[model samples]
Target: MLQRGVRAMRVLRASSVGLTRPAASRSLAPNAARFSSSRSRFPAPLVASPLLQRAGLFAAAAASTSAACAFCSSSNVAMSPVAEAAVAEKAAGQQPTVVLYQYEPCPYCCKVKAVLDYLNIPYEVVEVNPLTKKETQAFTSYRKVPVCRIDDEVVVDSSAIISRLRELVVAPTTASNEDEAALAEEEQWRQWVDQKLIILTPPNIYRSVPEALQAFDYCLTEGKFTPMERRLSKYAGAVVMYLIAKRSKKKYGIEDERQSLYSALDSWVAAVGDDRAFLGGAEPNMADLSVFGVLRAMHGLDTYEDMMRETAIEPWFSRMTAKVGSSSRTASN
Candidate 1:
């Protein structure tokens, strides 16, 4: 009975904040020209400095007249049939609704936010309580969050939500051989982020008792925990998570979790190469956004600061931060 209780505690700690940092303006160097990939249907943003580039991309995206703040519905651009239908519906006054069910700390939820911000999609956020999880009770099929409702259709899982959102905005188009290869590469790395990178997060976040406590403290500060729950989670939760993180290291055969994270990021940098400002050449693709979102969850923690200091990922990360900075379209409930 004791063993079962301990296991449940570990699981609960594994599942579960927000850190508010003031935004800043930033710049980026030039990148390679656009490739002819067909997988992801992202807007073709301008390739230039931060302000000028984003300005150009926003121009391309065109401002929407709809009350919904439809950022991507440009009349000049040819969208996929599905996207066109959504636009047409919006025109008919049936504005599309997007709602995200998530908790702030989850990397998976962050991934969805990154995609939405980059795509300039307006969405509402419903922050689910980590303890009761009563908010997500309606989603009995799959309770774990990052569940999203696009209009009337509910999509579960981060990757699936991203894919569905892509279908709603951009239409498929032909790409050159080189572009196809690049898109394929983007898809490959996006999968890597989920498979290889995400698993390393908890181990580093809870590598030691202090780190674990720090993580919980940040969570409690940003979360909606009651006073009693806060005390229990801040103290007891930290110790449990610390032990679970150690066991996680053994399970994954990771001798040094930080080193593994650094090496993995190094591999990503190499794949990105120095010529391109992003994996998607001039603009960020799905893979770039995925990595940024996952890593962003570690903000305000030691592991994140160490990563910025120790790795070459900072430049690219900074550029992405500038590009995908907070979206005005987002509202939190």
Candidate 2:
């Protein structure tokens, strides 16, 4: 059984007091942006900083606007769709509703979020309670996230969800042997990334005790946390995740975790090859999205810098960032 403390820590934003609107419907709230932007600079935990002192006051004011927050929805009121009523809608005329069940700090969730935006598919965010999983229990018997329900068709796992999104949104390019082979090859790499590559992130991000603290700091600050919760969540959560990262490192067969991370970056860059701009040639495919999404979790950490400075992955990572960042369009509420 998963430990209660671990689950509690994962619930960085899981609360009953305030509502959180899905990101697909609106731009990030200002304080929310600051929290996210801090990813680029692993600053001190908000608890230690002056910001935490008044964050509760700010949040109290924000609660009025965020009554329709990401985790919970307002009664009868819905998160407005991203595109026009016609554009984001499917052919059936009845507009499709996509609800994504996720945890705020999870990498797989980050991947699904990227692809949903990249494909311009609007989705409502349901922040699952890591401890109780109250939000996802009705739909899934097991406790896992990045579970996407597209209208009535529900999909689990990040890669599967991405594949489903592509099928629904991306136009079929061709029906040829070459196309078949290309897609097969992409699928192989995508699967490999899920099984082998992504496991590197946990260990690397939480490489050291201090590094682990910084990561939880980012996670806690990015979400809403009371001052008391911030301090307790930081130290206690950091120690737990740091130990967990070590176990993950061993499970992934990473003899030296940092070296394995560097190797993953180098291998991916090599796979993309010098002949093309991306793995999908001019544009990124599911393979590209999968890698980028998993890697997104490492942003702002010291590990991210080592991967960038030491490997050739940064150029491609930046390109993917630039392309994917613009894809998140806010719906008019």
Q: Give me the runs in candidate 2 sitting further than 4 Å from their true place.
A: 1-95, 132-141, 152-155, 223-236, 327-333
Q: Which residue pairs clash in candidate 2? A: 19-69, 20-69, 20-70, 21-69, 21-70
What's the C-alpha lDDT at position 254 in model 1?
A: 88
- Model 2 per-residue lDDT tens digits across residues 1-333: 124323433443343222222244433221121111000111111123221132121122122111111111111111122222333444332324677776555677777777766665567776554334456667555334556676766555554555444434425434578667767777777766766676676688778988877766543543344555556545654555565566566755778877887887888899899898778777777788778877776777787778888888988998888766553423211
Q: In terms of lDDT, which candidate is strongest?
A: 1
Tens digit per residue, CA lDDT, model 1, 172-253: 3666798778878987997687668876877898888788878777445544556766566466545555655676578679
| Runs with alpha carbons beyond 4 Å of true place in candidate 1 | 1-95, 139-141, 223-225, 229-240
All models: lDDT?
0.61, 0.55
Estimate the overall C-alpha local distance difference test score of candidate 2. 0.55
> What TM-score number comes out for model 1?
0.71
